[model samples]
Target: MKSESIVVVGAGVIGLDVALVLAKRGYGRNTTIIAEHLPGDTSINYTSPWAGANFSAISASDANALRWDKLGYAYLLSLAAKDDKDAFVKESTSTEYWDEMPSPAKIDSMAKYLKNFKEIPAGDLPSGVAYGIEFTTITLNAPMHIRYLLRKLTEEYGVRVVRKRVSDITSGFLSKDTKVVFNCTGNASRDLNGVQDSKCYPTRGQILLAKAPHIQQNVMRHGKDYETYVIPRPYSNGNVILGGFMQKGVSTADTFSYETESILSRTTAMLPSLASSETQILAAFSGLRPSREGGARVSKEVIQVDGTGRQGVLVHNYGAGGTGFQAGYGMAIEAANTVAEELQALA
Candidate 1:
């Protein structure tokens, strides 16, 4: 049942996970990861390395979306439990605040898998918050974990990597042997040739890294107007990220002083320990979250391979926005299954 080789474009978290899943599912030796950016490369266009990378999701209403959330949550929990340093996931705590109390249905549904889930008492709540939930969660050393994936894909799983820019599917298709192409290009799909999906857009997020060793837990406040969070990079020494705003369609990388101060004011207020004199600012930056107007697209299509007469299957697993890290594996599993089904039909 072995088919022709496959090509995977993009090396971000979503793409890497997709490659890893494909490798694990018996497509190991024939897959190649081609991308403009790889792990350890920093660019405003690259979002995975800059993630808060926590294992929490906003209240997802769609059952399929919720299933992805739970699947990813469980996968991450397993990694956190493992003692491997390269995996870089560790058990942590999450306390999420809401400006108004969520529906009873919402709480009940989320609590089903939120280990150590509890409603924080009103007396302990900070001002300007109406409802809060605390649960056991996990944080990732994102960069380290991504590099680990790349290493495992190449060395352990026999997958190959070609770190190059794919100008477009027609001109940049990596191989003639490729029977299926997975477009995990993230937000780059808006301009990718042969598939410029207008639904793709960028949600710019700003962050400030701080030396806050005393702060070990994640805290977030969600409101109709805004959202703010403090996430500790677990294995990184004394580092935590304070962020942010999802300014849709904004691509500028400017980190304004006022915006920086605003992030500092809001995040430190949530955790007074962060404002201590011992804490020092390390860096400030921004990245564009790859977003689609109607959530992520994990569907399949039969299109001309490299604009040639020969047709091939193309599976898309991009446009995850901020939810990419949390629901990535779930999406990858589905994408891999789609690849399998398409190959079976071709057979």
Candidate 2:
């Protein structure tokens, strides 16, 4: 029998990662990634590009999230070790000074999963830091990582990436040959004609990217009012990602009036050494995270329209919220398994 073709919407990290996994499983020759935006083209519509994208699960108690995050962390660290080291790298990260520390239940699970987990020494703790923990985590340079995935998919798996805005799936663009449609459209899923999931909303996040002098690790501080983090980028871009503010339902793409200056001021205050660095302000950007009514919706379902038994299967993999890159591989694996099952049913 001929292979079943799959149309994966969105070329962001999740979409691309799903396509790659599907291809690796011998489904690549039959997969296509259709999207309105691609990597390297930073737009408000695409959230994958503008991400601090580290792997620290705030949802340790949530079984599904815990599984996804653990799988994702393992996958990312493996990729960092074998592939281009510069593409993704793991470094020591410190989370310090929380008004309230994480619940004991979650901390116990975290300790079991992380290989390099440890407590910060009392002497090294920041002024307000009452307690802190350090762990090994990976950070990704979105543009470079996405490009690398695309290149690998095209070169090794023969996966096709189509640059087009898909308003509806039932249109002529998809046909009987397309047995499975993985909806990884991120924020655009809300506007998709056939799949208008009203529960899908955007969470606005803004960040400042600046060149800092020789900072090679990650630092995060929690306060009564706000949380601050500084993450190093690839190849000593001399620039670190300083962010962020999570303003739910704020969809405007442009940088807000106060947010632009505020992020820089706040970040510099946290790391005093950044004050005298002769670094340049690269850019300030924002993206809307695609959040769903209930956390991430990674289920398979069938939609009927106009009494026609279209019989197309949708493996919904959107709603990573702000942690798309962190949970991407794990979610994609789940999505790929769903696609395989759907294809088997079709056969």
Candidate 3:
């Protein structure tokens, strides 16, 4: 039988992951990625590169989100265990401090990976922190991980990527034989011709990359009005990522100097090594996360082309917000399953 042809819209984490899963599931050689940007290109519109790219199990109570988080954790853990040099995944100690007691659902979601998990005593907790959790989690160098996935898709799975700005789902597919389409465009789903999800919006995030290899563990501080994080990448002499506010409904990617200072201040309080005289501030980056009023949209839909009256199968896997890297693999698996079901229905 000929390999099934699939057109995957978007080249961010979600799109790349879905394409990879489809190829692994017998869609090899004919799977193609159509996107305006590729893995290495760093743009404000592309959210993957700007991410701290760590798996902290922040899904909390949502059953669907938790399932995807667990799946991604297992998949990434397996990849990190590999001895390959390009595996950009690593294990790290994660400490999350909250001003109030964290929800039980959040605790339950992370219990699966609780090796040495502990709750910080109120006395030992920071001045404002009421509770805290310490556990090991997976973190990835976002750019490196994306490149690794791209290589795996092309070299190993025979998947191909095409650079194009798609206005609609119908025009996104380049392969004439494409029978199915996976709409994985992140924030672009808000304006894409066929999708135009009104609920879709952008959540702006900014991060400061600094040279702080001495910082080994990942730390997150959840305050009443502010949130901050410190993520250290161990490989490639990677820089420590000091992350910042989640400005909801903000679309502009401009980096604010004040926000950068706030990130440094908060992260420095957590890890003094970041303020060390030798530490160098490498760069600052901001990106708009593809957020939706509701949680991520990952389902199958039949979309009709404007010019061509024919209908096509569209497996939507976008609007993951900041959890894109952490949940990409799991969501992609779900998208691929939808594709399989659609193909079976057609057959």
Q: In order, what lDDT does every prediction score?
A: 0.83, 0.75, 0.80
Per-residue alpha-carbon lDDT of candidate 2 for residues 1-347, written as tens digits (9 for 90 to 100): 22337888889999998988887777777787888888778888888888875666443346667777777888887887777454655544545345466667656766787758887787877677666788887877776788778888888898887888866755413666777888898887787887788888998878878887566677776665565778777654567888777677889888875886777787777777777747577888887888876778788887752256666677889888867887888899998887677656544
Model 3, residue 2: displacement in angstroms? 6.4
Candidate number that wins on TM-score, 1 or 2: 1
Per-residue accuracy of model 3 over 36-151 as CA lDDT, tens digit each? 99989989888887888788744435877888887888888788788335868888899988887777887776775655677776778878788888887788998888888888
Flag regions of model 3 displaced more than 4 Å.
Answer: 1-4, 306-308, 343-347
lDDT of 1 by residue, 133-158 (tens): 99988788878889889998888888
Give me the candidate number with maximum TM-score: 3
lDDT of 2: 0.75
Ranking by lDDT: 1, 3, 2
TM-score of each: 0.93, 0.90, 0.94
Backbone clash tally (model 3):
0
Candidate 2 clashing pairs, residues 3+ apart or interchain? 23-28
Worst 10 residues of 3 by lDDT: 338-347
- What value of lDDT does candidate 1 attain over all alpha carbons? 0.83
Better of 2 and 3 by TM-score: 3
lDDT of model 3 at position 96: 89
